[model samples]
Target: MELKEYMNFVFPGLILKPSLYYQWDTRIHFELAKGLYQFKSEIDELNDEYFNRVYDQTTTLFNEIFSHNDELFLVTNVYKHKGDIKRNKKIKVYNHYINNKNIRFQLKEETLPYMFDDDDADEYYTSQFSLKCQKQDIRYPVLLKAICNQDFPPLRPRFNNRGISNYPDLFFINIKKNIIFYIYDDRGCEVIASDIEAIRPIYEKYNEWIDEYCREDTEQLFK
Candidate 1:
């Protein structure tokens, strides 16, 4: 599907909002599921072992939730979330890499009038790549880790300021599956799917590691 068409399905009416907003949208919506990772210390992020596990589980979830041959779009804002144009050093480098790879992207300026005032629309230098469910491709894990830790290049795993790793936002989407997975600040993640059965099993499979608040929020959402 064209990017416009796919995006319309995900964020109907050109309403660019977070997964939380989509969960409540009646026109195009999904069953909400949440997961959390156990941290050893308040100052610590996911250790190597659990980090790899999260990557593994996430990739597995992607593969299982959608068909092997289905088209998947790994979409995210490449913008560094800073105002000073000169300070966009990291995403600038990453943007160069993206251009070299010939990824399809667009520059978006979105404003939520109801939530905010003063015409301060957030600008997003968004990049969207068509992907598949193959585990052999190194892109899946690397990008997933980047989204998790918010690291650019995503090659070496590490945290940024206050452990708030990487970019403005990131999303995993499959139009056919009617699902969108959103990860935030390496903290946790939530998936919204129209068909509850599509994600229920995976959530249950990782229940022990899933954050209780996430679980409760999802439960409350559907109830």
Candidate 2:
């Protein structure tokens, strides 16, 4: 499918432009933020225990919400972290993944004038590919795990050498169910659905694991 066709199919009426917040119809959605805690200053190594727990939970949640054998569209938005003089090459994380995995990708060129108006958007692009479910074996889980582990360039623009936001870099779409799951690093993840009732089971099943700040608001959507 063409780039526009894929966007229309997965995102529908949502605007494809940059925004301070998600352009989702929040009336039927919930934003799950990762809970942050103060770290011990003397820690020698970062403990990703929480990250692993969340990732495992998400893996189970995906299997529950989505059919174990369904084909899903995995879309990733790559950012060119310009101004990083340490690395003066066009990013090729996804390219490496494609070549390593031998998968095809549909590419799209886009610009977030708000984020990178000065840089050419052609260098920053989006890739769309087909991914199978857990029944198909490890490909699906491995890719998502790699993204959460920051194996590729993040999905945010750089300004004065810093990232702009903690937005999700990639998302998996279940077109048939009209649902989208977004992974925003170890900090958190989000799941948006067209039908509240359809997602209530998932919400209830995982409510305890939902970010504390978003719990109340998420609960309100069910009422």
- Highest lDDT: which candidate? 2
Worst 10 residues of 1 by lDDT: 25-34
TM-score of each: 0.57, 0.63
Q: Which candidate number has the best TM-score?
A: 2
How far in Å is the alpha carbon of 16 misplaced in model 2? 6.5
Itemize residue pairs with steric clashes in candidate 2. Answer: none
Q: Give lDDT for model 1.
A: 0.47
Instruction: Note the Cα lDDT for every prediction shown.
Output: 0.47, 0.50
Model 1, 1-223: lDDT tens digits are 6556776665555433355434443221222122334454676554455566667666665566556555555454433323445333333323422322433233232322222222543532333233322222225555566566654334354333321123446666666766666666445565666566656665566555455545565555444
Writing each residue's lDDT as its tens digit, candidate 2 over 1-223 gives 5445755866677533333126664422323224532233478444456445645766776786678555555554534433434333322434434432433333334433323354565434332223333234334465556655562243222112233222325666665676777665545666776667667788777767666666667677777
